[model samples]
Structures are given as C-alpha cells and as structure tokens.
Target chain A: MLSIRNLKVTVAGKQVLNGLNLDVKAGEVHAIMGPNGSGKSTLAQVLAGRDGYEVTAGTVTYQDRDLLALAPEERAREGVFLAFQYPVEIPGVNNVYLLKAGLNAIRKHRGEAEVDAFEFLTLVREKMQLMQMNESFLNRAVNEGFSGGEKKRNEILQMAILEPTLALLDETDSGLDIDALRVVSNGVNSLRRADRAIVMVTHYQRLLDYIQPDHVHVLTGGRIVMSGDKSLALELEKRGYDWVKEDSAAA
Target chain B: MSLSAINQPAAALDHYRALFASRNVPDDALGKLRRASLERFLAGGFPTQRDEAWKYTSLRRVESRRFAPADAMPIGADESQWIADAGHRLVLVNGRYMPTLSTPAPQPPGVTILTLAQWASHSPTQVADFLARHDHAAPHATPPTANGAFEHLNGAFSDDGVVIDIAPNVQFEQPIYLVHQWCMPASARSAGSHMANPRIIVRAGAHSECSIITHWVGDETAESLTNAWLTFDLGVGARVSHLNLQEEPSRSFHIETTRLQLATNAHFGKHDFALGSALGRSGTLVTLGGPGANVSLNGLFAPTGTQHLDTYVHIDHAAAHTTSQQDFRGIAAGRGRGIFNGKVVVQPGAQKIDARQSNRNLLLSNTAEIDSRPELEIYAHDVKCSHGATTGQLDPVSLFYLRSRGLGESEARALLIRAFAQSMLSTVQVGAVREWLEARVQRRFDLSAGEHS
Candidate 1:
C-alpha cells in the first residue's frame, strides 16, 4: 500500500534522511523504532507532505501514484492521515466544527453526500465513547488548554472519525498515562481492518504490547537496518539500538 | 513659518467663517456656543503628526478636501443593510433626522427621545446649558497637543441628531437603534463633496439600565465625510451597553469621538467595530468618576484595500476601587494600515484599581501593516495594571494543520482569519447584531483569501 525507495531528505540545509527504504502491504501493521535524532519522525512527516522539508532525491509511491506531487490537502483527501506528536492548540476553532469540516471535505472529494449534522454528532459521540473522552470536549477549542493525555485521545478520536486508509502515528504514546495508553490502544485496535494500513513510530516498545504489530523495523543512521517479526521489539528493548547499528555496519 | 503655512490656516479659517456666517440665525446662547467651538477649531487648524495622539494617523487627506454642509434632502435609501427586529429605530439621513423613515412608536414613560433640532428650537438656552455642562463633566483625556479639532467642528456644524434621556430608576427593555445613513445628493455630481456632523447625547439617570446600537452606513456612490460626536452620562448605579458599527462606503471618510462618564457603582460596556471607510478614525474616552465604577471596552478593526483605520482609547480611574478592561483586535489585508493606541490612567487617590489592556493584530499580506501601542500612567501605589500588544501573521503551523485536515489552502486561511476575529464577534450580546457582524466579517476574509490565492 505504501513504498519508499532511497528517500534522501534535508531540512534547513542539513541532510536528515540520508537514504531510507520502507514498504508496507495492505492489512499489515508496521512499527519503526529508533533512538533520538535517528530520523524516525522525519520519515513520517515526509510521507504526510509537510513544508520546509526538501526531498533531495528519492521517490515515494502510494497506491501506485507519486505521493510527493500532491499537496497536503489532496493527500489528505486521498485517505492519508498523520497523527501529530504535538497537536496544535487552535484557540477559536471548535473541535467538533473542524472534525465536521474535514469529514465533509473528504466526502465531497469521494463523490459522497455530506454528513448531516445529526448523523455527524451521533458518529462523533460513538467515537468519543470509544476514546473515553468527555462530551464537554466537543465544545472546547481544538486542543486549547487540553491535558497531554486528553490531546492524544483527541487525536485518536479524529483518526477514528476520519477513517483514513493509511494512518501514520508519530509518537502517539509518548505522553499518555497507562490508562490513557489502554484507551488509545483500544481505539486503534478497533480501527484495524483488512484493507487498511497502519505505521507507528515510537522510541519505546511498551505500545507494541497492547496493539501488536505484524512487523518491527529498527531505523538507525536514517535507514532501516533491521527487520523482524513482533519479537524484534522485545529483543530491541532488552538489548538496545547500538547492536542493530553495528550489525548494519558489518553487513 | 513658511510663506504658505501662514496663508493656509488663514484661508481655512475664512472658509469656516463664511460657512458659519451663512447660517444667519439669531445670536442666541446656542449660536454663541457654536461660534466659540468654531473659533477653537480654527485656532487648532488640524492635528499634525507632531502631536503624540496623532503620531500614526495623518489628516492631510481630509484637510485638503473641500466639503460643504450636506443639504437636508430626503431620498429613498436602501434599507436592506439595516438590522432586522432592532429596537425602536431612529434614522438620520445626511445628519438630518428623517422623521418619515424613523419609527414613530411611543417610548415608555420616563424615557424622553427627541431630536437636537427640536430641543434647540424649543429651548435654545437649556440646550446650551446642557452642552456646557457636558463639556465640563468629561474633560479631554488625551495629551495637550492632541486637540479636539474634529469634535469642535462637529459642534459647529451639527444641525440635527438624537437626544435620549432616561429618567431615574427606569429599565429600558429594548435597545435604542440609531442609523446614520448617507445617500448621493441630487447635486453631488456637480458639487465636489459634502460633510455631515451628527451629535448623539444620551443621559441615563440613577439606577437606569439601557443598551444603544449606533450604525453608520453610506451609499457606494457617495463620496462624503462624516464627523460624529457621542456622549453618555451615567448616574449612580446606572448600566449601559453601547455598540458602534461603522461600515461606510469605500470612498467615504469617517471620524467619531465618544466620551463616557460613570458615577458611583455605574457600569459601562462598549463594543466598537470599524470595518469600512477609506479613512476612518475613532476615539473613545471613558472616566470612572466614583467608587465601584467599572468599564469594559472591546473593539475589532479590519482594514482592507487602501483603507486606513485608527482606534484610540483612554480610560481613567478617578475614584477608589474602580476597574477597567480593554481588548482590541485588528486585521489588515492588502495595503491597508491599522493603528491601535490604548492608554490607562489611575489617579493618585484611586487605590485598589485593577486595569488590563490587550491588543492583538493579524496581517494577511506582506504589505499590510498594524501598529499597536499600550500606554499606562499610574500615580497610585496600590493599583494593578497590565498591558500587552502583539502583531503577527497567521501561524504557519496552524494553517498547515488545517490544510492537512482536507481543507483547501484558501479555506484554511479563511478559517484561521475568522478564528482570529471570532473572539471579538462573540462579545456582541445582541443575537441579530452578532450574526450580522459574523457574516460580514466572514465574507470579508473569504473575499480577501480568494483574492490572495
């Protein structure tokens, strides 16, 4: 469903992603693990088409189409979603209003009818229940004065509402407590479908315990150096990322 | 002085003298007051950039124009822009009260509503006495150099306006809606341009409660100047809410000065919206004269195209245990320029005073500019005063976040712009006024964003 080959990227005149390659098929869950400054977040941001990042040389193909050529909104309309590590705090835009606008935009792009207000509220209430979010959150500004755990849950709630085909989670579990982690895991686990793909980037292996991944890849020096099954996350947690760097160097 | 500098003021003074002479009325008390005001305006020709209060705004464009007094010719004006279901309506066309267009519904007992012209014709001496008393009650809060040239001009030329007097202990249920509209005069094509000066004086007695909405509008084809003066005197425990909406034609110029006086336990709230006019300036001065007096000022100014909008606000805490708050927002697009200067003063004996001032601005284009200044003068040691100002463009991160949610670039920009303005729009308590303003503000930003992309 997604493919990246020798992705060379630079930010602010400095090369961040030297050479990276990754591929994921439909219905598969992949986890990318790396230490600090290992370019794990860069890959996710590059895939989501953020500005200020120059793709020096590489190709990214999504569903057999060049993803880099499309604008961020066009990519989003085509079922590409990125759960930001730090959700922006918009002071005046209500949370529900943004969700409705986004959902309608995607629906219009797909030649579908816009969601009615009543139906939209019903769907949102159901999703909020899954995320264990309070109803008062619907009326508040988007992430304005929200707690760390509440912001993460709001992001997951947005993900569930949008229902994207390709979901990229960047450090979604970094600041969540254990209970919030469980709720967020349940929300994500419920979204697992046969025709969808999920890619999670994390620095710890604790998240993999709740929502198990089908494949685990160790990213070091801006490239994936090791690929194994779910057991690889447990092994990497026990040992460290240095061994993977050494193994790739010897190879 | 230079050769033309001396001759310029002389020429301008003669022009006004001729205009005043043309009135040809009896030399009564009201006439004398008008002559005195005209003399004051002539003494201070027009404020220059040297004046601290007029530092960022220039009156050269207005000074160079020759605008005769607008004739009292009643013509059919488009009423589609008027707020629907707004309380008892009082319409003024070209500064003259239009009795045919205004609502004739009788006001409740203890509420007296009349035109300035009516009052002046009936009791000229009483009207003169009231004006003198009002002038003395609310002194100029600006610097010495910042003379009241336009206000004095209004006093000299104002022929008709609204005068509302609410008796003590009265509670006005419905707001008093006043509309000051301008239309193309029959001879405007031949004549260069015209000017209108309207005065609104509202006096609320002790323990009275009321709301006032003043709207200014003009025809697209009319290129005129409107100088308006409004004053509100609140007795002890009186409460008043005033909303001023200025949306003149693009070719028009607008200048307004509002002075407010609050007595013991009186509360005053004002919302000023300056959205149109080629060159617009609004000055508001609020004085808390007695203990437990409070005032809140909220304003939003959006200047698009070549429009230049300026708002100046001054609040004085003259008594003990008084409080004040000022929040203003400015949105400037195209080559427009916006200016906001807010000053707060706490007198020596005004202990336990709490004052806060905040001004935030957004520039939609590189050429758009906004100047914000917050000034504080404190003579009391036991007062808490805070002020802050920030001017910036739309947050790139916030824009990207919206775009990533499937909103087009222009849509994302429009949404963020509305978000910036939503805080001020939400403060309008009247439902019809709030919705109308919300639509107008949104449509404005949407068009600007469309032009950009």
Candidate 2:
C-alpha cells in the first residue's frame, strides 16, 4: 500500500532522516521501533505532508499516486491520516464540527453524498462510545484543556472517524495509561481491514502487547537496521538498543 | 497646528446656526438649552486627533461635507417593513419625528412616550428640570471633560427626538425600538448632506426594568451624517438594557455619544455595535454612582473595504461593591481600520470594586489595521481590576489543525472568525436581535456556506 525508497529529509539546515527505506503491503501492520532523536516522528510528518520539512532526496508512492506532491489538506482528502504525538489545542473549534467537515470532504472526493448533521452526529457518537469518550466531548473545543491521556484518545478517535487508507500513529502510546492504552488499541484494532494499513512508531514495546504488528523494524540513526517478528520488540525491551547499534556498526 | 487641522468646518457651523435660528423659541427652556449648547459647540469646533480621547479616530469626513439638518422627507410604509418585528417602533426621518411612521403601544398610566417638542409644550417645567440636571452637571458627570464636544453638538442641533419615562416599579416586557432613518436629499450641493442629530432620554424610576434597541440607518447612495446623543438614568434598584446598532451607508459618517448614570443597586448593560459607515465612532461612558451598582459594556465592530470604525468606552466605579466589565472585538479587512479605547476608573474609598476590560482584534488583510488600548485607573485600595488587549492574525497552529481536518483554507478562516465574533455577539440577551446581527455579520463576511449554529 505504501513505498518509500531512499528517503532523505532535512529540517532547518539539519539532516534528520538519511536514506531511510521502508515498504508495507495492503492490510499489513508495521511497527517502527526507534530510540529518541531517530526521526520516527519526522517520517510520520513527511508522509502526512506537513510544511517546513525539506525532502532532500526521496520518493513516496501511496496507492499508485505520488503522495508528496499533494497539499496537506489534499492528502487528508485522499485518505491519509496522522495521529499526532502531541495533539494541538484549537479553542473555539468544535470537535464534531471538524469531524463532519473531514468526513464530508473525503466522501465528496469519492463522489459520495455528504453526511447530514443528524447522520454525522450518529456516526460520531458511535465512535465516541468505542473510544470511551463522553458525549460532552463532541461540543467542547478540540483538545483545549484536555489531559495527556485525553489528547491521545482524541487522536485515536479522529483516526477512527476519518477511516484513512494509510494511518501513521506517531508515538500514540507514549502518554496513555493502561486503561487508555486498552481503549486506544481497541479503537485501532477495530479499524483494521484487508484494504487498510497502519504504521505504529514507538519507543517502548508495551503497546505491541495490545495491538501486535505483523513486522517489527528497529530504526537507529534514521535507517532501519534490523527486521524481525514481534519477539524483537520483547528482545529490545529486555536487552535494549545498544546491541542492535553495535551489530549494525559492525555490519 | 497644520493649516487643514486649524480650518474649522465653517459650512457645518453655518448650517447649524441657521437651523438653530429657524427653530429658536425665545424665552423657552428648550431654546435656552439650545443656545448654551450652540455657544459650547462654537468654542470647541470639530475635534481633531490632537484630542487625547480621539487620537486614533479622525473627523475629516464629517468636516469636509456641508450638511444641513435633514428635513422631513416622504418615506413609504414599505421602506420600513423589514423592521416590523421591532416592538413599539418610533421612526424619525431627517431628525424629525414622523407620527404617521411610528407605531407605539398603549401607554400605561405612569408610562409616558412623546416627542421632545410635545414634552416641551405640554410639561415645560418637567422638561426644563430634566435638561437642567443633565446639562449643568454634565462636565463632571460621566466622562469628565474629554467627551463633551459631540454632546454639545447634538444638543445644539437636535430638533426632534423621543422621550421615554418609566414610573416606579413598572416592568416593560416589550422593547422600545427607535429607528433613525436618513434618506438622501434631492440636491447634495444646494441642500447639503443630511445631518440628523437626535437626542434620546430614557429614565427608569426606582425598581423599573426595560430594554431599548436603537437602530441608525441612512441612504446607501447619498452622503449623510448622524451625530446622536443619548442619556440614560437608572433609579435605585432599576435594570436597563440598551443596544445601539449603527448601520449607516458606506459613504456616510456616524458618531454617537452615550452617557449613563447608575444609582444604588442599579444594573446598566449596553451593547454597542458599529458595523457600518465610511467613518464611524461610538463612545460610551458609564458611571456607577451608588454602592452595589453594576454595569456591562460589550461591543463589536467589523469594517472592510476602506471603512473606519472606532469604539470608545469608559466606566467609573464610584461606589463600593460596584462591578464593571468591558468586552470589545474588532475585525478589519481590505484596508479597514478599527480602533478601540477602553478605560476603567475605581475611585477612592470604592472598596471591593471589580473591573475587567478585554479588547481583541482580528486583522484579515495585510493592509488592514487595528489600534487597541485598554487602560485602568485605581485610586482605591482592596480592589480587583484587570485589562488585556490583543491584536494579531489567526493562530497558525489552529489554522493548520482545521485544514488538516479537510476544511479548505478559506472555510477554516471563516469558521474561526465566526467563532471570534460569536464571543461578543452571544451577549445580546434578545434572541431576535442576536439572530439579526448574526445574519448581518454573515453577510458582512460574505460567508454563505458554513452552518452558523
């Protein structure tokens, strides 16, 4: 479903991602494990088409289309979603209002009818229940005055609502507690299907215990150094990343 | 001073002098007020930016035009049908009361509604007493001395207006709507632009409660000027809500000054909306005279396409336990300039006074400008007072958040602007008026797509 070949990226005159390559097929879940400052978030941001990131040399193809050429909103309309590490607090903008606009935009792009307010509210309420959020969450400002766990849950709720083709979960499990982690993992697992893909970027192996990935890749110094099954996550958690770094250096 | 600044509007003064002479009733009390007012206006002339209160607003548009007091022009009933829902409409065309155009409710025994001329003829002593108490104590009454220029001008040239009096303990459920319409004269050069100066006096006796909605509109094609002055007095334990809407033509000018006096436990709330006019200014001065009195001054202005709007507010906490709040917002686009100056004063011995002032502005274009200043003066100890002013573009993070949610850039911008406007507009207690103002705001932004709910 997505391909990245030799992705080289720079931000503010500093190189962040250097010659990183990854590929994922349809319905596959890939977990990119990396240490701090390894450009994991940068890869997620680049895929979602955020500004200020200069792609020095790379090619990202998604569903037979050049993804980097589209604007941020166009990429969203084309069914690309990014669950931010830190969700932005936008005061005065209603949560359900935004979800409706997003859903209608994607539906319009696919030549479908727009969802009316009543129907949209019904759809959002169901997702809200799945995310374990209260009804008042729909009326409050988007993420304003929300706690860390609440923000993470809001990101997952948005992902569930948009139903994107390729979902990039950037550190989604960093600040969540055990209960919130269960809820968010349940929400993501419910979205898994044959035609959809999810890429989870994390620093710890706790989230994999809930939502296991098909393939596990350890990212060190902006490049994928090792690939293994889910047991590698447990191995990294038990032994740490220094072994992989030393092994890659020796290779 | 510069030559242009020193050059007074001679034609305007001449026009006022002629009108005063034509209507001067010798040895009458109203004439006495007019004569003294004319002399005061002559002394001050037209205020320039040199005046500290009017530093950001200029009256060049008002001084350049030669305007005569508007005559009673023929207006068809269809012209005012849109304002039909307004209860007890008192229509004034060209500063002249049109009995045929007005629809007043049946007055109770203690409630009195009549034109200023009729009041002078019927109850001259009472009229003299009211005008005397306001005009003599005016300089020290509400705004001190800085805001007396326009009040003096309106007093000098006000030919006709409405007087509403509510007796003790009277509760008026329906609002009294005053519609001041200025139709263009046939000849702009010969007859000059219309200058409609209407005076409104609202007095609520002890324990009385009421609401008033004042609308100012002018011809869209003609050059006109509206210099209005309103005085409100709330007796002990009275409550009053006043909404002032200025919707003049884009090529015209509108300036208004409102003076308020709140007695012990009196509640005075005002909503000043300046949404139109080529050059518009609305100034409000509220005085909390007795202990436990409270006031709220909330206003908003949106100007685009070379329009200039200014809102000035001053609140005085003169007694202990009094509270005052001021919330003003401005939106400028396409070279539009908006100015907001708000000041709060907590006098000596006024303990436990609570005062808050907030002014937020949005500049939609690079050429648009906003000048906002919020000031506080506290001579009393043990008081709580705070003020804030912010002028900037929309938040980039918020914009990106909305755009990433599949809203187009313009749609996202409109949503944020609407939310900003709603903050001030939602304060209007009247549902119908709030809805009408919301529609007007939507039209002002040309936003046709988004749901306003």
Candidate 3:
C-alpha cells in the first residue's frame, strides 16, 4: 500500500532523512524507534506535505499514486494524517468549527455529503468519548490554553474523526501520562484493519507495552539502518542506540 | 499659514460673523454667554496640528474655502418620507428652523428643545450656563490653543441652533432626530463659495435619558462649505446616546466642532459615521465631570473618489472612577483619504478607571490612503489604559479560509470585512437604528467589494 525509494529529505536546509527506502503492505503496524536527531518526525511531516520540507532526492508513492504533489490539506483529504507532536493554537477559531471544517473538506474531496451541525456534533461526541476527551474541549478555541496532555489527546480525537487510512502517529505518546498513553494506544489499536496501515514514531519502547507492533525499524541520522521484529525495541531499551550505531557501521 | 494647510470655506467664517451680528440678543444670561463664548472662541480660533488631540488631522478643510450662510433658506419638505423611522423630527435648513417641517415630541413634562434664536431672545442666564460649562476641562482642554479661526467663525455666525433639556428621572422612547437639509441658493452669486453655520445644544438632567440623531444632506450636485458647533450636557446618573450621520453632497465641504459635558455617574456616547463629502472634518471633545462615569466613542468612515473625511474624538476622565472606551474603523477607496485621531485622558486620583482606544483602517487600493492615531494620556496612578492603531489591506488568510469553504472570493472578503466592522453595530441599543446603520455598511460592502474583493 505504501512505497518509498531512496527518500532524501531536508528541512530548513538541514538533511533529516538521507537515502531511506521502505515498503509496507496494507494490514501491518510499523513502529519506528530512534533516539534524538532521528528522521522519524521528518518522515511524518514530509508524508503530510508540510510546506517547509524539501524532498531533494526521493519519490513517495501511496496507494499507487504520487503522494508528494498535494498540499497539506489536500493530502489530508486523500487519507494521509500526521498527528502533530505539538498542535497549533488558533485563537478565535472555535474548536468544533475548525474540526468540522477539516472533516467536511476531507469528506467533500471523497465525494460525500456534508453533515449538518447537529449530526456533526453527535458524531464528534461519540468520537470524543472513544478517545476519552472532555466535551468542553470541543467548545473552546482550538488548542488555545490547552494543557500538554489535552493537546495530545486532541490529536487522537482528530485522528479518530478523520479516520485516515494511513496514520503517521508522530510522537503521539510523548508528554502523555500513563493513563493518556493507554487511551491513545487503545484508540490506535482499534483502527487496525486489513485495508489500513499505521506507522508509529516514538523515542521510547514504553508505548509498545500496550500497542504491540509487527515490525520495528531503527532510524539513525535520517536513514533506516536496522530492521527487525519487536525484539529490536526490547534490545534497544536494554543496550541503548550506541550499540545500534556501532553495529550498523560494522555491517 | 499656508492655504494648503487649511481644510474648509473661508467665507463660511465671514457669513457666520454676519449672521450673529444681525441677530439681537436680549440683555440677559443668554447674552452674557454669547459675548463670553465669542471672546473665548476669538481667543482660541480653529484648531491645528499644534493641538496634540488633533495632531494627525488638519483643519485646513475648514479654513481654506470661502462660503456664504445658505443666503436664503431653501425648501426641504418636498417629501417627508425620506426618514420614516425618524420618530420625532426637528428640521433645520441652513441653521434656521421651520416649524412646519419639524415634528417635536410631547414635552414629557420636563424635557425641552428651544432654538438658539428663541433662547437668545428670552432667558440669557439659561443659555449662559451651557456656554460657561462648554469647554472640556483636562490637561488637553487648552489643546495648545493653536488659533481656532473657524471656532471663532462658528461663534460669530451662531444665528440659530437648539437647546435640548431633559428633567431628572425621565425616559423617552423616541429618539430626537435633528435633520439638517441644506442647499446653496441657486441665484446667489457665491459661485465657487458657500457656507452654513450649524449650532445645537443638548442637556440631560440627573437620572434622565436622552438620544439624538443628526443627519446632514445637501443638494447632491452643489459645492459648498459648513461650520457647526454642537454642545451637549448630561446630568448625574443620566445616559445619552448620540448618533451623527454625515452624508454630504458629492461636491461639498463640511467642518464641525462638538463640545460635550458629562456629570458624575453620567454615561455619554457618540457614534459618528461620515460616508461621502468633498472634504469634511469633525473635531469633538467629550468630558467626564463626575466620578463613576463612562464614555464610549465609536465611529466609521467611508470615502470614495478623492473624498476627504477626518474625525477627531477626545475623551477626558476629569474625576475619579471614570472610564472611556473608543474604537474607530475606516475604509478608503478610489483614491479617497480617511483620517481618524482619538485621545483618552485619565486625571490624577482617577484610580480604577478603565480606558481603551483602537483605530483600524483598510485601504482597498494603492492610491487610497488611511491614517489613524489613537492616544492615551494618563496622570492617574491606578488606571488600566491601552491604545493602538493599525492600517492595512484585507486579511489574506481569513479571506482564503472563507474562500476555501466554497464562498466566492468576493463573498469571502465581504464576510470578513463585515465581521471586522460588526464591532460598531453591537453598541447601538436601538434596534431600528442599529439595523439602519447596518444596512449602509452592507450596501457599501456590496458595491465596493464587488469590484475588488
């Protein structure tokens, strides 16, 4: 369902992803584990078509189509979701109103009828409950004065509402409490399907305690240097990334 | 002084001197006021940039042109339906009243509206009080005394106006509408120059209520000048709302001065909307004489095709516990130039006084220009006051946001502009008046934004 060929990415004129290649079929959960300065977040942003990043030498294909040619919102409408590590705060823009706009934009591109306020509210409430988010979150301004945990939870709520086929969970577990992490993990786990794929990015193995991944990749200096089963996460947790760097260089 | 620095009719001042010289003032309180006011006005003539309160706005529009007092009053009752919602109408053509065209409300037991000519002919003392208490007292009250030539002219030409008084604890449902319809006498040899001196005074008693609407219209094709000084007073525990709509003929000039007094626990507000004119400027001062008083000054201006509109509103919290809030917005298109200067002053010991001032402008094209200055002068120790002014084109992000949602680009821009301006509409408590002003804003957006947005 997804393919990447020698993806060379640079952000702010700094190389983040250097010569990385990957492929994943539909029906699989891939966890990308890397220490600091890894290209994990850059991969998520590049996939979502953020404005700044430059794909110096890469070609990304998703569902057999060119994924790099769309705008950020357009990519979102095409079922590519990037759960931001830190969401933006848009003042005077109602949380529900913004979410509704985002949803309708995606829905319209998919050739679906627009939902009315009442219907959208009902759908939002159910999704919020599933993500264990507060009802007031939908009433306040988008991400304005939100707590760290609240921001993380809001990303999950959006993911649930948009229900993207390819979800790039970019550090979704960062800053979340044990309870919030479990809830987020559960929300992600429930979306696993034979026709959907998810690529989770994180720096710690603690998230794997709840949402186990079928495959694990270690990103060092923007390239996937090591690919293994879930045991690689456990090995990294025990031996640290210095051993991974040493081993990758030796290989 | 450079002729280019002046803004209005030169003969307007000359005609004003002639009008007052011709009127007979009885030897009473009103006579004393008339004499004292002329002296003070002569001492402090038309304001200039030297006055910090009017630092950004030039009174040249009032000083340069030559105008003659409408010469002979022209008829205005061709059709009374023009202002149907105008509950109680007071018609004055060229500063002179015609009772046949006026429809005053029942006195409500204690409220009265006496013209300057009538009040001057009778009780001079009652008229003196108004003139004596007219000057707004504050650090900026003197306003550098930068030689107010037109003020002296307005003082000298004050032939007829009105004195409105409301007794304590009285409330009226209908707003007093003062309609000034002017026309340059077709036979008059004024040719390139014509002028009209307009005067109006309003006083509200303690705990009393009063509202007034002033609308200015002239022959759409005539080119003339106008000088006016409208004074208002509010007693303690009283509230007053004043609305001024200046829609001048396509080719005319207007310069007006407004003096306002606010007593302890009194609230005074004025909303000024200047839409069309060859050249127009409104210089006003509102004072808070008593503690715990509030003043709200709201204004909007739209000028097209090289039209010049300038508005200066100043508020003084002379006593403790007084508050002032001001917001003015303007749109200049077709090479029009719009200027707004607003000032808020909080006196010493006026702790807990809250004051805010904001002025914004939207220049639709490169040729169109807008200048705004919002000033705050505070001597009080514990007051909350802030001021800001910004001028720019439309918000591209907001426009794109709306357009992406299926609204056309023009519709998107109009919606955002309307939302930007709706802040002024929220203050009008009268439903009909609020909707009336809103209609003009909507109409303006429809016509102007259609071509550009």
Which candidate leads in DockQ? 1
By how many angstroms RMSD does model 1 differ from the true structure?
1.8
Rank by TM-score, highest first. Answer: 1, 2, 3
Ranking by DockQ: 1, 2, 3
Docking class for model 3 is: incorrect
Under CAPRI classification, how is model 1 graded? Answer: high
Runs with alpha carbons beyond 4 Å of true place in candidate 2: B1-15, B22-27, B77-86, B108-110, B136-139, B185-191, B446-453
Question: In angstroms, how far off is B190's CA in candidate 2?
Answer: 8.3
Report the error of model 3 at residue A65, Å: 5.3
All candidates: TM-score: 0.97, 0.93, 0.71
Provide the TM-score of the second chain in candidate 1: 0.96
Better of 2 and 3 by lDDT: 2
